[model samples]
Target: MSLGRYVGRRLAITVPVLVGVTALTFSFVHLLPGDAVDAIVGFRDVSAETEAAIRAEYHLDQPVWDQYLLWLRDAITLEFGESPVTGRDVSATIGRRLPATLALGGAAWLLALAIGIPAGIVTAVSAGKPADEVGRLAALAGIATPNFWLGLILLFVFSVRLGWFRVLPPDAPLVSLATVKFLVLPTITLGTAAAALVMRLLRSSMRRELDAPYVTAARARGLPERTVILKHVLRNAFLPVVTVAGLQLAFLVDGAVVVEGIFSWPGMGRLLVRSILRRDYPVIQAIVLVIGIAIVLANLLVDIIYAILDPRIRY
Candidate 1:
């Protein structure tokens, strides 16, 4: 199929999936024990009338289906309503926090690519050698390590003992040097697993490509080893890596809650954790919807990239 038609088809499939996600998120969030009003008021006791008024105001007295319909309607127009906990607009809150998450995720993604691709290439080229063995071992360790534990270790060594970085992220603008300094440890902590995953996948891909008949054909044509690998093999090997990277990018965007909390980063992940704790329904629903959108779009982008990288791929 044509590129435009392919994208349209994917988007068509995505809309219903996102709607289902929203419905499920709304239902599941409401199903959690404890009322949002009680969470909002904390330990303080309020009058019965006041509690009723609060519930009426937020339509908490409505049926689950009613609330979901109301939310879905508002969401269509990009209106996410106010946070029950903070009384702030959900969209505004997300807007403020999203940049931080993007910065963190983007830096981590770049770091992963910088490390993973080259390491994968090296490991593949030197397969069965000590370097390959060491790379595999390190990748295994990276995959096994927990992000929160790694963040704490990095924070303790770099920020506590060495004083090279700060425990808490800075209040500086996202583009500033101070922000970049603060992001280093978090980036490394977040990116390590993704890098390891990419490395292993790419190494396997390249090894398979190396054994393909085309690699021998190129070599027989008097092409340099570097040319044969880079020009012919790596392109084919990179297709799976592209898919993994795209999915990882989506995961990084929404799944950095633990890392963000550990480092006190003011990102969407941190906001999500807070919203969940406080029973901020609107915020939680909005965040989940955003995550769903990200995942769908990331997959779409990956499909497009696949078609671009390997012309043999078709919709």
Candidate 2:
């Protein structure tokens, strides 16, 4: 299929997928045995008038499908509604927190790419013993370990023991060096996982490409090893790697929820936890929709990147 046609089809499919996400997320959040108001009142009694008022405020009295339609309508218009938990506009709430998550996620992905690709390259070049074993070990540790444990270990070693950074100070400004210090542990935790993934993908792809007929012909024709690898191998090897990194980047938004909670970092992941605890349906639904859109956009971006890297795809 032509690139334009492929992109158009993908965009068209996104509409129904987003509607499904909004409806499914809405239904699940509400079906958890309580409404937003009930979660807020904390098992306390409420007057009939108060109950009615709360229901009216959120349009909770409306039918399930109608409520979903209303939320969907507002989302399409970019008005994500208000958070009953905080009385803040949901869109505003997300906008404020989004950058921090993106920053952390970007840092993680960059670090992973920087470290993993080099290790993969080296391991591919030195395929037999020492380098191969070391690279495999690093990848194994990164992949086998859980993020939360890594985060805690980092926190204990760096923050509590060394006095290098806090577990996130509530009053400190985010732009300051102190906040950056606080982000280090969580970033490492997230990056390590991503690094493992990148290394495996790059190594596997490079290994396969090295064995391709074009690479063998180049080597036979007396082309420099570096030129053969760089000119002919890395491009195809990295196409899928780019897409994987993009998908992983999206996870960095919400996947760090546990790490953010552990370190008390002020990011979307932390905000998601708060929204979940309060049973803030609108906030949760909005966040879910935004994440869905981000993933779709990321995949689209990957497709573009692939086309750029492999010109044969242009047609």
Candidate with the greatest TM-score versus the true structure: 1
Model 2, span 83-121: residue lDDT tens: 767889998888878887887778788889989889888
Q: What is the Cα-based TM-score of model 1?
A: 0.87
- Please write out the lDDT profile of model 1 over residues 167-257, one tens digit for every residue: 8877788899998998999999999998999999999999999999999999999999999988899999999899889998777657588
- Relative to the unseen true structure, what is the Cα RMSD of model 1? 2.9
Tell me the whole-model lDDT of each prediction, alpha carbons only: 0.87, 0.80
Residue 86 of model 1 has an lDDT of 87
Report the error of model 2 at residue 106, Å: 1.6
The true-versus-predicted C-alpha distance at residue 153 of model 1, in Å, is: 2.1
At residue 146, give the lDDT of candidate 1: 95
Instruction: Specify the highest-lDDT model's number.
Output: 1
Per-model TM against the reference: 0.87, 0.84
Worst 10 residues of 2 by lDDT: 167-176
